[model samples]
Target: MAYRVQGVVVREKDAPATIETVIVPDPGPGEAVVDIITSGVCHTDLHYQQGGISDDFPFLLGHEATGRVSAVGEGVTEIAVGDRVILNWRAVCGQCRACAKGQPQYCFNTHNATQKMTLEDGTELSAALGIGAFIEKTLVAAGQCTKIDEESDAAAVGLLGCGVMAGIGAAINTGEVKRGESVAVIGCGGVGTAAIAGAQLAGATTIIAVDIDDAKLEQAKRFGATHTVNSKNEDPVAAIQALTGGFGADVVIDAVGRPETYKQAFYARDLAGRVVLVGVPTPEMQLELPLLDVFGRGGSLKSSWYGDCLPSRDFAMLIDQYKLGRLDLDGFVTERVGLGDVEASFAKMGDGTVLRSVVEL
Candidate 1:
């Protein structure tokens, strides 16, 4: 039997999302049905509303979620009914070239439910990030369910499902930040601030935060930034160099993703230092750097896809840290709201009023 649930859905390009009746079918083989407890509103959800992600109309618009498995399908042994889990998009296929090489974080093939959740009239709604978790309950592959400590706060730790995890992973995994290293994160949004916290967690001695917004810069300080630079009034590259003892940082992460910020990150690192680009860029955006300068820099320039995170490994570790009071996952939740408030939260998110507005199901 299919369960009737309410989900936030975008019906057309640039259309505001609305609550609609979603038909969540019983899991098929290798699938599980999750009863969502909480879901976080991310910029990616807004991007779906604005037609930035795809032309897949009627997209189910949430992914960062925590849920309990309510049912499991045949052959689904990895997860069982009643498991507390954090939803993840990367359900790595072990045979994929990336996974076979032991880099499951770069898995080229991930799994989703073989069955589709539909509208009352049978229109198939595209699941955002392959999770479609804005609804009361969602069906997903069993591998998508990563079991975590049930005592962890659902509203807060669910962020590990996406953006928060991306930021932390960008620092810890992609950048491979080392103890006593000097690190600079460009952008003080959710991802950038998380990078600051991740740097602290990784034992970085100096963390510099660069942003145009003074308020955000201040917030970054709470996340363990040692110094804040207002790029609006100063040359950020020069400022970073000056702060790092006339040398640049060991690692500079571009969290804003624009060409200008990328340039700043490129030049804000010490010779042979790493620059991690965790921010998502549009398809139309082209990066043109001088070939000689690229060779002259003599450093690694890498892009972080999903922060190079291996969810099965990272999620549990992060949840345990949150429980140990070592990580401030709660700091990321700026507001708690009901499902209808998601559209309003989008406006606040645009104006930088909130880090994340989460929907508590």
Candidate 2:
């Protein structure tokens, strides 16, 4: 039987999202139906609405979600009905080259539900990140559901489905931060602050947070930053170097994804150290650097896609840390608003008034 539920939809580019009734088909082969409990209002959703992602009009706008498996289709055996899970965008195809090579994080072929959900008028909806979850129920490939502890707050743990996971994985997976190391994170937004928390979890002795906004810098400290640098008033590169004993940090992560921030991250790392770019850069942006400086840096320059995360492994592990009270997942939830307030939450996101304004379903 088909299910009808209200979902947030962006009908046209730059148009405000509207709440409309969507029809969710019963689970098809290898698919599962999830009763979504909560979803996070992320920048990606806003980007999708603005046509920044693609021309897939009538797009379903949320992906970071936690839910319970209400039903499963034929051939689905991993997750049973009533299982608590977090929905993930990356559903690795084990046969893909990346997965076959034992690096499923870069799975060459990811999967989504074969079936499509449509409007009451029968218009197909392009789900954001292949997991449209800003509704009462959503359908996705069984692999997209990562089961975690049910005791944890869904609003908090669901964030691991997207941005928070990206930030944490940028440090622990892509950056490979180590104990006793000195680390610096550029941009104190949600991702950067999560990187700071990841560094602390990895036991980094000196964790420096850099940002133009003093308020965000303070939030970064609450997320485990040992030092803060207001980039607008000071030179971030020099400040990071000074904080690391006149030598640059061992690892520097650029979370803002701008050319200037990338340059700062490049020059703010110690010789033979690593620079990780976890920020999503705009298509028109370009970087220019001297070849001599590139050679002189003598370290790795890497880009992290979705924080190079392996959902099945990283999600559960991080949830365990949260349950142990080691990770401050709750701190990331600055506000909880209903589905109707998602547009307003986007405004707050632009103003930097909240770390994350989650949409409680």
Question: Can you tell me which runs of candidate 2 are displaced by over 4 Å?
Answer: none
Number of residue pairs clashing in candidate 1, backbone atoms closer than 3 angstroms, sequence gap of 3 or more or interchain: 0
Give the clashing pairs for model 2: none
Q: Candidate 2: lDDT of 10?
A: 91
What is the C-alpha local distance difference test score of candidate 2? Answer: 0.93
TM-score of each: 0.99, 0.99
> Candidate 1, TM-score vs. the true structure?
0.99
TM-score of 2: 0.99
- Residues 232-347, model 2: lDDT tens digits: 99999999999999989999999999999999999999999999999888778999999999998798999988889999889889988998989999999999998888889999
The runs of at least 3 residues in candidate 1 whose Cα sits more than 4 Å from the true structure, single-residue gaps closed, are none
How many clashes show up per model?
0, 0
User: Local error of candidate 2 at 45, Å?
Assistant: 0.7
